[model samples]
Target: MDTPSEPGQPTRLLFLGEENLADGFRLIGFEAHPNPSPAQVEQILRQLQHTHDKAFVLVDEALMREDIPQLKRVRREGGRILVMAVPSLQGPTALSSDVAERLAALFGTATLRSE
Candidate 1:
């Protein structure tokens, strides 16, 4: 027999990190899943793509060592998802990259500053 869905269920947000982080997200009413390894992250993401209402994925930079390549492929295939690489509790924040400089060089916006 099929079961009915719950109407007020909170939307899911995947968080691949340490247990502490997971517990923190849960305190605020979010469904946080932990994955500290690349293999686990890959498997969880593949499975989550089908079930659970995942709005955004928060992957730590360390996990990116292997997960990034796989994610790039998913993006290239036009997957309708937003995977934001975030910082682990003991790691640096995302967006601290030289890609912006490279982008600026390519688009000539290096010196375009805002006041």
Candidate 2:
């Protein structure tokens, strides 16, 4: 980890999404941004851009299509700050996860169960 303020500090994990997911992530030690506005999201992204520490930012799948220019630029640039899209806490939407499908393929239907 490397930063102007704190050299050799530990890498960070971030969860930028809704409140439902934020509380749980915060408890697990991730820096949580619950239901942030577009501007706030952009600001955070900009801040992360400068800090030269490896980090994982877990963004809600729904926010993947954010119209923020900074986010668009970050996605286009592709840096050490890894970004991942996860499902919302409210459950799967149109952008549903394929976890069930993958699990079924690996373990077979008899071993898979639905909620």
Candidate 3:
């Protein structure tokens, strides 16, 4: 959690995933962490809900299963941190993303796989 940014400062961007992705995100100015555990993710989300004015958090999709109660609560609470699941470097991910689901719902599943 951090103090509200000055009038000119940009909101923080955080990425939690494998080292390869973390390195790239760091190059682009995100506060990146490599291979964070589920507990750590919960802690970060909880902290963000309480203090920061706003942030962008990209999580390793494989690490977060939507069923976790803590995660569900954080999302439901409408925190300042915008949390999103992203593809990780660890093999193929079985996890699906909200964006993908929404796109499929809007355009139909056939359109998604057609590309």
TM-score of each: 0.56, 0.69, 0.70
lDDT of each: 0.57, 0.74, 0.71
lDDT tens per residue, model 1, 1-115: 4333345754466677667777877677655766556666666666655553334666655665464555655444533345665556664343422454476677766343322
User: lDDT value for candidate 3?
Assistant: 0.71
Write model 3 residue lDDT over 47-84, tens digit each, in one string. 76666447888877765564555566755565556777
Q: Candidate 1 vs candidate 3: which has greater TM-score?
A: 3
Off by over 4 Å in 1: 1-11, 51-54, 67-69, 77-79, 91-115
Deviation in Å, model 3, residue 112 alpha carbon: 3.5
Q: Tell me the lDDT of candidate 2.
A: 0.74
How many residue pairs clash (N, CA or C atoms closer than 3 angstroms) in each of the candidate models, in the order given? 0, 0, 0
Model 2 CA deviation exceeding 4 Å by range: 1-8, 91-115
| 1 or 3, greater by lDDT | 3
